[model samples]
Target: MSYEMKPLEFISVKFSIGLLLGISCGWLFPIPQELAILLSTICLVITSLFFLFENYRKGIYFGIAAFLSFISLGIVAITLAQPKLSAHHYSRDYNQDNGFWILELREVLKPTNFNRRYIFQVHALNDSARSGLILGSIQKEDKISDLKVDNHLLYYGKVHPISPPLNPYQFAYDSYMESKGVYDQIYLNPENSIQLKTTGKSLKGWAAQIQLHIKKELSSTPLGVKEQGVLRAILLGQRNDLDPEVYRSYKDAGAVHILAVSGLHIGILLLIIRFFLKPLMSSYFGRSTSMIVTLLILWVYALFTGVSPSVVRAVAMFSFITYALYLKRPTSAINILALSFLAILLIQPKFLFQVGFQLSYAAVFTIGWIYPLLIRFWRPRNRFIKRLWKLFAVSLSAQLGVLPLCLYYFHQFPGAFLVSSMLIIPFLGILLGLGILLVLLASLKSLPDSLALVYNQMIRTMNELIGYIASQENFIIRQIPMDRPGLVLLSVIIILLVLSLQKKKFVYLCFLGIAIAGFQVWNLYLLHQNRQKNEVMILHQVASTAILYQNGDVLYVMTNDSMRIKTLVENFELNRRIQSTRSIPVPNSFYLGQDQWILLDSSGILPPVRKNIKGLILTQSPRIHLGRILEQSCPDRIIADGSNYADDIRRWRRSCQIYGIPFYSTAEMGALSLGQL
Candidate 1:
């Protein structure tokens, strides 16, 4: 029997899309609270009016009312998701101020390469009571274990807003943190910061404590650090201990999701649980009890994983499925998927902006909708062949779903994803099953050394296999140009094509073909637009100076660093889709159209900066008297690149200030993008 979708299957999906769009609008073009309130009220009134018209059965007005209802719903969602804190909630005086403040540690962050970070709530700021999420970083010390979530701390710190990207095409670290409700950061001295013994008696705190204990136990095991890290990631969703090289291996091998506890991980765990409770599966009451036990375990697992976006989505999906079975209610995968997504967004609307959240839903939802179609296209006689085909179908479906997003965000494609998934997933699933068992036994202090040894060696073997796969450069395609518009257009095409395939309609196929042609034309048009650009950019890089001059699709780069300038040029090339970048040595002067770029170096002498020399590029910490240079030859602006000393830049800034010459600091203002000369 074909599984027919329910009538309201798309309702939640529709509302969720609108809700996200509303959130995006509010975030991108934030309005004042008063203005937002007014807009919400206006939408509400219009929606009410439309409802009245529909009630009167006024001549196909129901269609208009339905459309207006979605609009009003989106606006209302925006109003609800708006941050309660005002634009200036944090006192301006606290921007650079450092003082003794009490902070309640709320969440433990995965330690990065630099330091151990945490999300702390401000209890008292310099003796004044205040509230907000603060990104707290503790210097890595031997006593890192003492810093636990829920422990109140008194510390001296400086408040700083998260800095934007220092380079082009880089990840927006500030926006990513903001989406998770973090605004300010505090750099705390781990030794001096006094941790208060008093801890909050909360579920999150308890979960964290348990997690810490498991981590502590894992640290004592005989397993190697890399093995331990992989096991921890697969078992507990903690990957801070993972080596950078190992992480890269997994990413390139297309197995990074296995390290993150998402739908796949949870599904595997549920299967393991069901297997363990096989004796109870024969009876009704026993099955119900086992189902309840499975749900509790899933939630506990979610908590263990820090209740992250992926964890919450996975658990939510499993909850709907498990309960549907228990209640003997009809369940549609698409409807369940929609319901879970809508539920999560309603609670935390900002998750809509998260990449993990998008990927998790997209992958699972696509498998739900597309796998059946792919499975039916081919039939295998043997049961094992059938199972393998199902796996292939699922992988292909998910890959197709997330392909656009992957390209847009990561700018890479895993050509070996199919081979890797087919060859490694079954083994990885079994390994994870064993890993979960070991973690529990290890936590209980009853793990066997022999078992640990075998597990460790197996993990080593798996890592080697993944590394070998990644080493095959042919399978890892990088540097795909996919920006915002490209992502949207590709997604639309995917959706329409999928629909066409399901319906098998000639009109839909024709529309799909037209869309494909239109998208290709749009890409070519964009390339043409970029081909006419002529400009220069002073990039900000610590201890390095790189200048990019773009003429049409071709680029010219000048840098003083002896090292390869591939990274810098690659970032620019991918973002701008440049045709070629040529690195040149620092020249005496460069010309762009009729304008001139005069260079200032370590000579400590001011050259004759004439009227035609309209720009000054400062590098190598020149000791020249900038005030005197302004009098001798006044350029339109003095551009300071990152190669100069900070002290020198400060002095130059002051000199420019006195002479009324505009000093553009790439360090402060990000990469300087100048218009066509």
Candidate 2:
């Protein structure tokens, strides 16, 4: 904690921080295109001048300041250059116009049950020059699997903007798509008026084709379907074929990173190659040859895995270390980590928003920084004990880095993470080595049943162990709901606590306790606010409806179906920080302050509505004449939840439009808040 940073470490940290800050500023306040371009050019010149003129300067302090400014300016240049991302824009009337769009499929996503989706670039809109990324989905079929990246497809459809989440605190599907540069969707049924033309091969297309071939070979193996799927995920970074429960098991057990193909996998592969080629690598030249071959093989593995972010990150960091060792230079883990991050973000600034990218960097950086301190705390006499203790310390350090972010995003903690890690990690290197052997043998059609059986059994045993650990539901803590403020404080406190152990500062420990206490107090204060809330809310869910009316600490929920009550109420209950929830049947009515609500559903039961009746609630696609009802009785608004059909909601909306009545649909604008808050 009291140690000074190495010169390289300090510069790397400053560069990474400045780059992130620059990106944040650019995103928060976008400037005019011309201004951005000019500013970027100026910054680039300044940075170039700083580096070129650095030899003329003296004193370490001056050198440090000059280099920091150089990095800052370079980052500002990159941030400003992001205007180039939006250089090509969709026309204003593109969404409204419907026609035959001849587009080339640029990026093919995994196929779903009903459709195969791709991000297509529009080459021609009815032979008119136009360009933009369109999310095109063609109907799924046995033949549709032949579609490859860079294939031109003609489709007739209206491009509609992606819709927002129809529920409170639901996954922001639209925002997620936007982050990926997809704004409009063209839902097409290729069984009818769809044309497919194969274009020239692309790297991505080639990668996909190779992956498909590999998958077929693996599928033909004697291994179980789910087992092969998991192995493929481990080797090739493909998880769509994995069973949902199996994936969840790995995640809950805190061993999900095994499937992600990171530093551990790459490290294992490098070591395996080095060990096997040792006989030929006895000479000095052979050692150098081995290192060169290993590095090339690592890159090839990255290439084969479709150059995924997690894989690329690991490869980049390892590549840096390898290059340093190959050329005989001093290396630093923190510096390598910071460089990899900056390199990735410079290419695509938006990757900074990715959860995987954030967590990967955080875990690596924490392990590099804190694991050393943890090991220094206790020195084991035995080598085995040292290795075991090191593994535990590394896991703890990584978890410490990721725990706050995990709680903020997932709202749960896997208590068995350390246990699952301890059991699986020591053998992972061997498991990976065997997995590679199996793949190589299987691909070459020379796999022996005995070898295959052993590898399959290892995988099966690992899966079962992880699944058993995941099933310890009592150890898994759920619904922590740590907000941004609490998460930040908790992360800082954790760092300080570790530093306290290193520096032997009790004051740091006291500050850590105070931060925890502050988070608890803030959580309780928010709970009190929620307990005092009074309102009626209709939550939006797909084909389900739940209306909540709460007054003070009491919550009464009414839904058309009882089956989804548990899933629907979880977020609300967590928001309120209340464990008890009363699921009542659709009642005659409910009240919030002076307002009244009448429950009407598919039964078409409509109570007489007057001025005091605040809103008319519609659920389960009620069959009634809304215009006639509005004429007979006047209410403030007509509210419909997600249980109603989309067609019915549109029809009712039109009717309300004709009658000049204010209409609200949960399926359209998200959950409706009525009465008092």
lDDT of each: 0.78, 0.75
TM-score of each: 0.90, 0.91
Candidate 2 global Cα RMSD: 3.4
Query: Would you give me the overall lDDT of model 2?
Result: 0.75
lDDT of model 2, residue 611: 46
Off by over 4 Å in 2: 1-9, 44-85, 91-95, 110-115, 124-132, 139-146, 191-193, 277-288, 505-514, 552-554, 608-612
Model 1 lDDT tens row, 528-626: 888888888778877777778888889988888736456778877887779787878867677777777788888876555555468788888887878
Q: 178-261, model 2: which lDDT tens digit per residue?
A: 665667787766452465667578777777777777788877788888888888888888887888889999988888888878
Superposed model 1: Cα runs more than 4 Å off: 1-10, 29-100, 110-115, 126-129, 138-146, 155-158, 190-194, 562-565, 605-612
Judge candidate 2 at residue 496 and give its lDDT: 77
Tell me the TM-score of model 1: 0.90
